[model samples]
Target: MRSLIVTEFMSLDGVIDSPGGGSYPHAGWTFKDVQMDEAAYDIKGREQQEAGAMLIGRVSYDEFAPVWPTMEEFAEYNAMPKYVVSTTLTDPQWHNTTVLRSLDEVAELKQGEGGPILVHGSATLAQGLAAAGLVDRYHLLVFPLLLGGGRRLFATEVADKQRLTLAEHATYRNGVQLAVYDVLR
Candidate 1:
């Protein structure tokens, strides 16, 4: 079965809201020029190579649809199958985009013989997927600073306690730590 992998950048305080430019006070903190080597690029390259499709919520889809298709760097993601889980998203103008309205549909997509269903920037959808025990892996890149006031990644919206096992860990010179966890059943 294909895996549902979540990848997000967060502050030390677990704030995953608006890593890019947005309304958050420390919005663009993540992209600031920190010392990153080839290992960092390797991680990103690996994720893209392993991803068969991308699973995202309406908010993420809205954020990405307009910009990603235009970027030469994200051509791989644009070419891959993209699934947006939304009730209101009726038409997707981006190439290879598909709107999935239900959790069942998301689950069904996971059963496909693909590499991985990569999910990014879907906080509410991540919570829902966590509650349903559908998230297979979480790749969290934790920055050195603390936001103290933005939306958190591990919220209490989950229905029950779910444990996680650390599968991978890597630390960057600029204090960004990549922690990969497997959702334990």
Candidate 2:
């Protein structure tokens, strides 16, 4: 089976929302002071090469679908297949998109042939996937500042405990801690 990897940008206090400039009070907090370093660029390049398809939630898909297609940096990501997890979302205008209505559909998608399924910025769906033991890895870039409050990566009590093995880690000059974890099944 292809690996399902979840990547997130978080704050010191665990806030993950509005990193890409949503309506949240602390929106765009990530870009306030941090610039992309060599290490960060390397990681992004590596993920772009390895990810065959993107598995994301409705909200994140909505956010990315509109902007990424127009950005030069996101050209490759726009070309790759996108699987949006949503019950209310349909008729995706983005090229190479498949709207999935449930986690069962997501599981079915996982069984198909591909490289790693990259999950980005879909905290709720990702948490559901984690609970279902579908997540294979987690790549979190934790920033130094705290937002006091916002949506978190794991905001609720999961029914089961999921242990992770540290796979890789690094700290950038801009105070972003890049932590990679392998989810133990």
Best by TM-score: 2
lDDT of 1 by residue, 53-81 (tens): 99899988988898989999888898999
Superposition TM-score, candidate 1 onto the true structure: 0.94
Tens-digit lDDT track of model 2 for 1-185: 88999988889888899887989998998887577566765677788888999988999988988898998877768889999988898699999999998899988988989899999887798889998889999988898887888888885677898899999999988888989999886
lDDT of each: 0.85, 0.87
> What's the CA error at residue 54 for candidate 1, in Å?
0.2
Which residue pairs clash within candidate 2? none
**Per-candidate RMSD, Å:** 1.5, 1.2
Worst lDDT window (10 residues) for model 2?
33-42
Candidate 1 off by > 4 Å: 33-38
- The alpha-carbon deviation from the true structure for residue 161 of candidate 1, after best TM-score superposition, in angstroms, is 1.3
Candidate 2 stretches with Cα past 4 Å from truth are none
